[model samples]
Target: MSDYIVEFNNVTKEYVRQVALQNISLKLPRGKLIGLVGPNGSGKSTILKLIAGLVRPSRGSVRVNGRQANRMLASEISYLSELDVLYPFYTVAETIDFNAGLFRNFDMAKAREMMSFMQLDPGKKVKDLSKGNRGRLKIILSLARQVPLILMDEPLSGLDPLVRDSIIQSLISYLDLEQQTVIMTTHEVTEVEPILDTVVAIQNGQLRGMAEVEEIRMTHGQSLVEWMKHNLA
Candidate 1:
């Protein structure tokens, strides 16, 4: 009986005329780095939103740390989305301070350290920073939270190869597998393959596979990306 930090039980989400998710059920064990891979509009973001309590499921439930996903557990979970939603008027430091003040579990020191490592200018206003810097800032703020689970969606998108490498390195150094769980959704499967403990594949709003990374490689004799390409085809 492994302890689960996050659990989705037959969760479903629908938008007016379309079904975004269809009876999705999954359990995320504690302290594992899980990766979610799927094509666009496969309801990947919707699943993250449901877990973050940004949106409620149309049917079924999502639980975090043994409680219904809600604002009460905001301190226990940190979510970094694909979109950077910083206050345009605030400086990078100000944004971090705001998050720290809002979330009791936020670590200001960790945020500052991540900023320094990423070569981000804390004094620069959000509007003045480039897109890449904004993405890095979002990651720093999210990862710095002293939370049980961290959810990141498309963290590696919209960046050059060099910057992507730097982001990956920062994520690896910051992760503490003994205490924290990380769930990241990305199309850059190969980039994350080496670091992911488990991989969950989604297609057409349905779970295709969920298994340990090494077991997948052993059974398929191909990298996660290659396996995904064939299965997702």
Candidate 2:
């Protein structure tokens, strides 16, 4: 079995007028908190979509746990999209119940704990949620699933400072690094750099750099964001 949790081999993806990813290859090991960092339109989100089996690579292959990513792979991966895909009419409690009914791996205990950590109210309807609350709910739902891989596209986007802090803390609190790996995308690199084990930077749909967070700090004498600023300059 491959030791890597995620592997992309010579992958390229394109739309009609643009290429979102280009001849990219990456192998990420398990038991890590990886930060997918890049500017807008950098295809950071595309990587997560590929891993989640939501989009096909135009060329080559994407794999999770040595198996080709597909609909069945969804069973092993818990994906939290950048967009809020929950039913707006459903109360948070009902939404959690619905997901639990869908995935046997969904853990009600974990969901309730994370909800309390994020200060989410189970009785509140999704439609009444503020942007920050919606983001929190999305994360809570994903984290509740006991899966080997968790792919989050901009998990911190649209959140206020307080909620962001709470979410980060909850991630550290809830994740069992021995059993699972998390890959999250965000432009707010400075805020996330402290917890990241690795950082992958992409630009213009191509990989620019990737490395361990400490290697970056030791070699460049800067945080991931500062190194990105220097390199992206």
Candidate 3:
């Protein structure tokens, strides 16, 4: 049996009268490229935050590597948020070195290589770089971490077609599926469809569907984007 890296059991998260997640139960096994897809208000980011231990469930339990998600497991998981969170004054190399110092599992060499592959200058300050470069930097930093699980929230947002293609290629080339699992949330389903192993769709804080990408395509007889529009609309 595959070892489960993340398990959500009857999880419920609420913000006062609003329920962000409802009885969410999911078992994410190690080493799979899982895609989370849904509409704007579908709580996709919430799930990523929950797994990253940024938020706690109101009820039930969330486990990461068989331990409670709240505990410190910085070396085991790396989360790339939807928003850029780098220090504006820091240079790209400085940011990488800071993360390397903070996390024992961070690979400085891998980080440097990724920066070079992305054509991102190490000396460029975060504030001075273009949006695309910032996005690339975030991806590079997240990917350089030698962790078991990586969660990315909207990693491809706000990029041109060419840069998007480059980012996708870089992601695929850097990932080692045998040793790591990647969970990414994106509304750009068509661009990601080719590489996703599994798809998990959520609507209005509830799981709409979960299946292998091939199975979804076979059953619907359409691409993931077409299926998503047909189902989500």
Best by TM-score: 2
Q: Distance (Å) between predicted and true CA of 214, model 2?
A: 1.1
User: Cα lDDT for residue 218, model 1?
Assistant: 90
TM-score of every prediction relative to native: 0.95, 0.97, 0.95
Cα RMSD, model 1: 1.4
Report the lDDT tens digits of candidate 2 across residue range 80-131: 9887798999999999899999999999999988888888899999999999
Give the poorly placed runs of model 1, Cα more than 4 Å off: none
Clashing pairs in 1: none
Please give the TM-score that candidate 2 achieves against the real structure: 0.97
After superposition, the stretches of candidate 2 with alpha carbons farther than 4 Å from their true spots are: none
Pairs with backbone N, CA or C atoms under 3 Å apart (clashes), candidate 3:
none
Worst 10 residues of 1 by lDDT: 69-78
What would the per-residue lDDT of candidate 3 be over residues 89-131, giving only the tens digit for each residue?
Answer: 9999998998899888898888888888999988989999998
